[model samples]
Target chain A: MNAPLLKIDQLSASAGGAPVLHGVSLEVNAGEVHAIMGPNGSGKSTLAHVLAGRPGYVITGGTVRFDGADLLALPAEERARAGLFLGFQYPVEIPGVSNAYLLKAALNACRRQRGEQDIDAFDFLNLVRDKMRTMHIDEALLTRGVNEGFSGGEKKRNEILQMLVMEPRLALLDETDSGLDIDALKIVGRGINSLRAAERAVVVITHYQRLLDYVVPDQVHVLARGRIVRSGDRALALELERRGYDWLLEAAPAMA
Target chain B: MKALERILADFGSPADAGPARLAAAEALSTHALPTRRDENWRYANLRALEAVRTFLPGPAPSISPALPPALPGYSRLVFIDGRLQPQHSLPDTALLGSLRRSAAGSADAGPVPFAFSGDGRFGLIARMFAPEPIALRVAGSLALELISITTAQACGSYLELDLELAAHAQLELVERHLGGAGPTGLSCVQVDLQLAEQAQSTHTRLLQGAPDALHYDTVAVTVGAGAQYLLRQVSAGAQTARSTIQVRLSGREARTQIRALATAHEAQVCDALFTVLHEAPGTRSDQLFRGIASDRAHVACSADVQVSAGAPGARVVQSLRGLIDGAGAEVDLRPRLTINTDEVQAAHGATTGRLDEDLLFYLLARGLSPVEARSLLKWAFLAEALNAIDAPALRRAAGQGAAARLADTPATELLQ
Candidate 1:
């Protein structure tokens, strides 16, 4: 589909000298939603952090492309500027820096890299006000330091708020459902659903099928021992939830 | 000669000697000022202070400097070389009254002649062996009261402000050490403030001292029962400015908070020592000090907390965080606690680190140049404690002093 928005060819990432994702190849066409699911140690979070360019995660051998650009060669921030976003498994707390300020800076950064002049603060705040309303994110939260002292639910919502503001082309949700209640799950899922667009792609990383119930992905892949050993439609997630990954391991080879 | 020794010798006689003459004494103390060579004082430069040994101490005739007075509003304590220059001070109409008059005028005023000793600027500042001390008593029960102290001269000086805060009093003491290089000299000054019963005294000290001078000052606060005393100090990477603070909860139900901050650049060294003694029942004390060091500068200090068994229902938490950068830059933080009681809550933590790379990436990705990102993070380290100040002017001024220090960094882009 028009030069896959993101293509990961045989991607392998490691942490602490131990490999997590091993030779995993994936491709996401623009406007596609790809969900990666597996049992524990499935490297879901690793892929998210590695994709985000967090330090300590080494990409051993692979090529990541975004909009046909060499994503692997770019810094995490540059990748972000190129329309990539990662909703962290654990949103970091940066005390003293207001969330609104950070989001505005991030949005302007992307715009500047895309050859647009910076928007004035007055206009920028007005734009953010609309996005905050759709996500149901508290304007008060935006005024506080970035995620500092926020509850588990608030942090997840804050991440979605950033996604709403940044409007990245490729968004990676890393276990965004953990620590969220049913009500919060619906709110977060609705937030993600609203972002679905013909020009945007999303990667949902989850361990529970409950999250999939709301933010249904078009495709789901099971990762075991680092490699994705199974792939299918949304039903695969439900199947894995019914019978854990151990059953699949009996039928599959040690792909990792 | 070592800067501290020269400082001690200079103050040894400055009725007006102003720490300027000790520049000639042989630095016999084999103890080198902390350096990259020394482990504790590793982040700070000991030599920059050594070179400052010769500048004569004098008052700045000029209007301002790279680092000017941040807190412009307040009754200033103007000192030059250990002597108070009343001429440079605010108008004589600014003098409220004598300590006794202050206590007598306010219905909430308490006792007088409060004193305590803790190893720090106060330990040194307390050396006013003279029987008569400078006393300025304040009207009790006044809200939003502030006293500003200005170190106008470039030499070592001693200042003792005997303040009497009547019961249920809220007092804000803003002390700004303003003045730049004069003969490239150094100075050490002592500041003492006394608070009365049920009084809430919030003290914020902004360091705009001579870049190359040695600033060693002390704050002795003896809080009364049901009284609240909060002390906040920000240093602008002094050549060697060490302000020691001693807080003693001598009365039951006393609360004391000590938040001291230092941001050092180049080879300057700023150290703070705090001695908090929980000697009374139901007393509480908290200490948080963070230092951001860049360019081989050094900031080191120790927080000593002593909670005797006699003081039950007391809680003490002390935390020290340091961000050290550049090859030789270092921060040495030591938090010592002696708790003889089994019923009190006591926690001590010390963190020394460089700028957070992840946070740095997050900021730089947001379009902030690398320098601006680092500056924001450094300022963030201070906002928690400084923001707690109620006075907008003093808070803004404190923030300015912090920003000016960071602005001197070679890679700083935020200042631009």
Candidate 2:
């Protein structure tokens, strides 16, 4: 933890100049896994998008540092090439571009930024073959267009496959477990765990504690009204599962 | 000078014997409007054609135009003002040499067009200009071959052409019609094709109408035994534009398919009509045409199909769509079916609509500005239709061309 992988200081954001996330702060250290669980409109997805530099949500206050560099100043792809990745809740469908081609493009984009010549086609194929075998994924998935006409489980696993291939320094999984079955969940979790390293960090955003059972996180936080109201170890998620947001509502009126 | 008019008057009066078939035909059809003399000139307005009667015969004016590269792995031929410009290219092959020689010797004989079945401006020019027929003869079975046509003039007379492909040859043909509407220019074309047994062909046309720009073109496709044919035509809003495709399957086990799509802007009119005929038993045909009119642009589209009796295995499918961009854009799409054969599966459908709400929402939610979202959907819709091209280069170029015309949409963000 000499220099934590990502540091967020009093970060605030607005959509159409109206507050969405108000004074949110968090930290993720190398090799650590953090989980953010919240109800709808709790800004869970917004936080993931902001970190990936998606357009339109203006950063109003505070700062975000990823690997010692400013995160807010980069474009979405630039942030990606900088070792930050967001597995979209709803993966896009690029009709003519095959999944393998897209993944390779992303890998090359990242490698090029790090001043490395892109992996040749033969090397890329070999790399993909190995990753697919380990993740229990099939080669046919790579031949089709990116996530096009994919089933719910297929889309989620595709996201994990992307994560496995890119091996980003920081990965954000936005509701990756939402539409997946228990078996698919186990596969995704295994894929994530296999990549755990001191050079990388992970943040899995979910609406329920069910996902925590598969990929245990070192830290858990409850976010509501654009703010993280509670923080604890793995037990915090178990508490939210039993109690819901009832106590947060009871405390907010008096605090106001 | 109206190339057709001034020159034709002199040749008939014997002050000119410059009968380089194309040159001679240009002179004869150069009149102002449908006079009693022009055979194919009755239904459409020739007022714009007449206005340019005094125009000095200018060179094929120098142009600085650009279009998207062809789909990968395909041979390509690009043309400007109906003349194959040196700037465009095609893959090297013997078929390439044959087609070039055929065009120069142009329009060899074929069966006569059934008179009065399809008519107006382009028909007149086609009948009057190329008596022999501009043929695209395919020698053997080949893939990934493409041909494109473009017009970039503001005001000019019509250029009549006859395009034909011989039996046993296979390829993809793309006709791209473009021009400036200022000063009221006119372009007219006639394309004819032939496909033999075990041969396949596909044709795509993209056009926009000018306020005073009157554009008219016709396509005729004939297929032999066990051959396949696919045709699609797309139009943008304009002053007036009309394209008609007539196809027939004569040999047993022959198959044919046709589609037409149009997106019109303000104060414009477009018509995409198709005629399908199954002359023999075991022949099949399918056609779908969709059109959209936005920004107060109006369109009149129709389809006429006839399947001769005794063709027990004829099949057909057709549809049309139109989207009204603004308050004033208008569209008219019609599909007709004629069948004489029993035991046949044939269907035709047409639709005219506004922007699709679901498609719009999906794109906007992804951080694309509203305009950018609309533009992507527009191009995607056209791309799906163009994707049917056997030649990837034709598909890529058509998609890129249609996307560029959507200037208001900032699609430049994702295209590269």
RMSD (Cα, Å) of candidate 2? 8.1
List model 2 lDDT by residue over B83-161, tens digit each.
5554566646664565533332234433335323434335545444321233445665444333333344443333434
C-alpha TM-score for every candidate? 0.83, 0.66
lDDT at B328 for candidate 1? 85
Candidate 1: stretches off by over 4 Å: B1-73, B76-134, B141-160, B166-170, B181-183, B356-373, B407-416
- Residue-level lDDT of model 2, residues A187-238, one tens digit each, is 8888888878988899999988888898899999888888888889999899
DockQ of each: 0.39, 0.05
What interface RMSD does each of the candidate structures achieve?
2.5, 6.5
Which has the greatest TM-score?
1
Q: What are the per-residue Cα lDDT tens digits for candidate 1 across B61-135?
A: 333233334344455445444344456555235353433322211323222222221133222322321111345
Docking class of 1: acceptable
lDDT of 1 by residue, A22-46 (tens): 9888888888888998878878788
Per-residue lDDT for A153 in model 1? 92
- TM for candidate 1 is 0.83
Worst 10 residues of 1 chain B by lDDT: B20-29
